[model samples]
Target: MTDRRLASVGTAAESRLPSRYLTPMDLVAMFRLPSVETVYQWRRKRTGPRAFRVGRHLRFDPVDVRAWVDAQRKEVAV
Candidate 1:
């Protein structure tokens, strides 16, 4: 598939994902960061990925998180 087509597919798939889920600590740990508190700060600043609450718990869709991380990876050309 062409790059454009692939990108379109990715965009569509991502759009179907939930925008909220992971708790501040979960997010930080998933990202392998140092402090969980930083996740909260990011939420307050609205600079990190979107998140939502489910009852008293927070969660992040594994697929969405993987997709987002993959998108951020640097591609190296041969």
Candidate 2:
């Protein structure tokens, strides 16, 4: 199989992901909160910042997520 196929199938066998990436759980932990389901909902709604896709897996850049969180903090502070 091709490298692309391997990345799409072999690596993501566990979660049916097309690529090996962070899950909603991983992100929630990084954010120090408990809102796994909400995060997934936000992804669907497209109102919770942005994310990236690798094959069939959803991934968030740590920097982008942190930046988004910072923006939220600023809004709340205001």
Candidate 3:
């Protein structure tokens, strides 16, 4: 079933990567971003949440992503 397959994939990824890190595709989905390419562009411009290289793959810390999202919030005077 699809759920079983997804669980297996998640387990495999967890074994390979640190629990605190997320792939660029994860970021795209989490932030509802346009595309993976947009993630790359943000990385290149240093305009997005901080990311780091993990054996040629990009990884993001959820803490950092949360902070970035908080910093981006706008307040309105009512």
Top candidate, metric lDDT: 3
Q: What is the lDDT of residue 36 in candidate 2?
A: 86
Error of 1 at 50 (Å): 3.0
Worst 10-residue lDDT window for candidate 2 reads 12-21
Provide the overall lDDT of each model, using Cα atoms, as 2-decimal numbers. Answer: 0.66, 0.68, 0.81
Maximum-TM-score candidate: 3
Predicted candidate 3 versus true structure: per-residue lDDT over 1-78, tens digit per residue: 999999999777546434578899998887798899999999999988899998899999876776676666732221
Candidate 2: segments with Cα more than 4 A from true spot? 1-21, 32-35
What is the C-alpha lDDT profile of model 2 across 1-78, one tens digit per residue? Answer: 598997887445434322334567777775665688878888899756578878887777655665577788999999
Per-residue error (Å), model 3, residue 14:
19
TM-score of 2: 0.59
Q: Could you arrange the candidates by TM-score from highest to lowest?
A: 3, 2, 1
lDDT of 3 at 55: 87
Deviating ranges (above 4 Å) for candidate 3: 1-19, 74-78
Residue 56's lDDT in candidate 1 = 70
TM-score of each: 0.47, 0.59, 0.67
